[model samples]
Target: MSLGDEHGFGSESGDRRSDDSFGGSGQTRTRLPGGGDTDVYGGARRPVRNSRSLITVVGVVVLLIAAIAFANQGGGEEGPSGDGAKGTGSQPTAATGVKPVTGKNGQIPTGYAKDEQGAQSAAANYAVALGSDGMFKSATRRDIVQTVHDPAVTDGLLSDLDKAYSADFLANVGLTGDGSAPAGLTFVSRTVPVGTKTTSFAGDKATVEVWCTGLVGLAGPKSTKPVTETWFTITQNLKWVGNDWKIGSSSQKEGPTPVNGDNRASSADEIAGAVQGYGGFTYAR
Candidate 1:
C-alpha cells in the first residue's frame, strides 16, 4: 500500500476593524439639563459640555451595532439564502425524496433512481464496494467489477485489475496466493465516505467525488503490514444504465489531507477484533 492524504472538516472566521475617526477634536457636545446661553431677552443659557471619552465610547458602540446588524443580516428565521445556501440546487444535504436502494447485484448496490441523488448514492456505495477486501478474491472481484462498471468497460477493467492484484502484490499486503489471509490473520480493507460532491452533472451522466478514509492490512501478530488508515478522494464518472447509475470510469487522487492526530495506535489483536465486530454501512448523500 499506497497511503493517501487525509482531510479534516473546518469553518473559517474573519476579523473586523473598528473605525476611530470622528470630526471636531474627537469631542462630543452634550446639552445640560437646564439652560446656559442667553440671547438678548436674558433667558437661561444652554450649557454645552465636550466629552472626548463619551464620544469615543459612542463611536465604539455605533461600530459594534453596525457589525452586529451586518452579521445577522444573513441569518435567522428566513434561513440561509443566495450564496450562503447549503446546496447548489433543490436538493439539500439531508436525505430527501426517494430512499437509497436496498437491492444489490451480488453485494454491489443496484437499482438507483434516474436523478442526482440516485447518482450520488450509487457512487458512494460503489466506492465502498470497489475498495473492499472482496476485490482481492477472484470470484468476488469479478462480481464487483461486473456489477459496478459499465458493460463495455467491465471486461477490460477485470483484466487490468487482475494484473494489478498480482501474487507479488498479495504477498506484500500479507495475503495468500488466492487472496486469503494467513491462518491466524484477518485482512482488513474497507472504505468509509466522509462526504460526496457532484463536480459535473447532466441528465444521463454525472461526475461525483467521494471523499473517503480507508483501512487496509493484516490484523494479527507478526503481520508486517499492520492495519493503518489512509485518506483519498474517488471520482466516479457514472452513467444512468438500466435504471441505475453505473461506473463508466473511476480514478483516485491523494486528498485534501489534514495533519495527523496524537491518538494511540491500536494493537494487532484489537484491530482484528474491531474489524470482525464492526460492520460497514450502505453510504448515501
Candidate 2:
C-alpha cells in the first residue's frame, strides 16, 4: 500500500529551502566556509631568505587572525551557504546553518520564515513530527495533520491515513486497535533527519528531500517483535501556508542508508528502558 503519505504530498505555492528548479544546471559552488578566503598579508610570497621579515610578518598575521576570530564569535548563519553545505545525498555535510525554528503549534513546530533555509528547517522538523508515535493514534494524528499539512488537503489526508492505519495494520505492527502498545512492551517509533536539500523551489513552493534514520517495532523480552532501526528518505512538497511552511503532500522511499556498524545490538529490555528514559529533540535546520 502506498499509504499516500509518502511521495503523494507537495508545496501550496511557496516554502523553499534547488535545482532538481531553485532550477537550472543542478550544480552549485559556494564561496567557501567562514564565508570566503583572503590573503591576510596582501602581498606575494618570497623564496628562501629573509628570517627577520618572515618572523615579523608571522607575528602580525597571528595577531590579525586572533582579532578577526574574536570579532566573529557570535554571528549566526545567514542562509543556505551553497549546495554542498546542505549535502548531496552521497555523504555527510555541514548544516545549512539556518537557525532553529522559533515558534511551535502545541508540540509541532510552526512559524517558519519565508526563505530557502526556512523551508529546509520546516521540512526537517515536519519529518520529525510525522514520524513520531503520535501518528499512530486517532486524536494525536488528527492534531498533527492539521498542524503540519496545508488546510486545503487536510480532510482528504485524514481519510487516507485513517484507512492506512486500519485495524489489520495495527495488528501487524503489534499495536492495539486504539494504537496502544500491549502491556509490558514498549512500542517505539522515532525519526532523526540526517540532512535536507531542495529538489525544487520557487519562493512560494518548494520540494525538499529529508534523509532520516528511525527506530520502530516493539521493545520487550517476551514480545514477539523487538524494536529495530530503519533508514529512509522523505520527499516533501511544501508551500508557504498562512505565515508558515506547511506540507502540500509527501512520499517516501527506502534508503541512502549506511551499512550496519560493529556495535552490539541491545537487549529488548535495554531498548525499552532507553526509549522510556531518553527524550527526543525538536529538529532544526
Candidate 3:
C-alpha cells in the first residue's frame, strides 16, 4: 500500500501548506531526525505529547509554507499564451500514462523526454521534492532549489527560499533552529500528487499543474499538534534547461479539495510507525 494508506490518510491529495488536518487527502507528515521536540533553532518551550488525538496546534505549521510563494501565489487554469501548437492534453490522474525514465542527478530525477508527457513527469517529481520536509533544512533546501530551478533564477530563488525558512518559520512549525523535532515528537510534512496536467507547452517552456494534498504537524502520544492534512494545487512554470526540464517558478492555490470522509483517524503511534515503515518515491506521470 502507498504510505498514505498505511497511515490514517486515504487516497488522493494540498498547498502546494495549511496546518489543518484534512481528513480525506493523502498528505502525510514526518519528523526530522534529531531532538524540545525540536532541535535548538528555538525561542519557546514545546508542548508535551501524550497521544489522545489532540487537534489543537494543528494550524501551527501553516506559516512554514504560507511565507513561501509556492503556498500563497498562483495563477489561473489558462495555459501559456503563445503561438505554439497544443495537444488535447493527457490524462493526469491515470495510474499510468507517461513512460518513466530511470536515472537521477544527485537525488532528483533526470532524463525526461522533451514532450508533453515529460513536462507532466517533471512537474510531478518536482512537486514531491519541493513539498518534502527537506525544505526545512538549509543544506537540503539549497540542493532542491538549485537542482530543480533554472540557472537564471537559482540564486535569487534560493535567497528567497532561505529567507522564507527562517529560524522563526521553523519555530512556528514546532521545529528547532536546526529543524528537528523534540525528544519524542515526530514532525510530519509531506506532499502527495494526485494528478498532473500540462496546461501549456511551447518551445522550451511548459506550465503544469500538480493537484496535491499534504500533512504537517507534530505526532506523539501526548502531543497537542497532531499531524493534519491539507489540500492545494501547484501550478509550475518549467523551462527546458540543459538537457532536462527545470522550474522557472511555481505557485500554489488552495485546491480542488475533496470532501472529508468518515475514515477513522489513527493514533499518533500509527502515524509515526507508518513514517518509519516507508520511504518516498520518484513520482512520474
**Number of the top candidate by lDDT?**
3
lDDT of 3 by residue, 101-183 (tens): 76676556777788888888888877666655555567766786677778887776566555655576456455677666665
> Which stretches of model 2 miss by more than 4 angstroms?
1-97
Candidate 1 lDDT, 1-285, residue by residue in tens:
111110100011011112100001121233345544442112332122121111111111111111111111000011111111212222213345777676777555688788777888887777666555555567766886688777877776566555545576456445677767777776666666778888999999998877766555566677655555544566678888877788776544444545454334566677666666555554445
Better of 1 and 2 by TM-score: 2
- Tens digits of per-residue lDDT, candidate 2, 1-285, equal 011112111121111111010000111222222321222111212112111111111101111111111110001011111112223222212236655655677666688778877888888877766655665667866887788888887887666556645676556556678767777777665666778888998979998887766555566667554444544566678889898888876655445656544344566667666666565555545
Clashes of 2: 20
Model 3 earns a TM-score of: 0.68
Cα-based TM-score, every candidate: 0.66, 0.67, 0.68
After superposition of all CA atoms, the RMSD between model 3 and the true structure is 13.5
lDDT of each: 0.48, 0.49, 0.50
- Model 2 deviation from native, Cα RMSD in Å: 21.4
Error of 1 at 36 (Å): 81
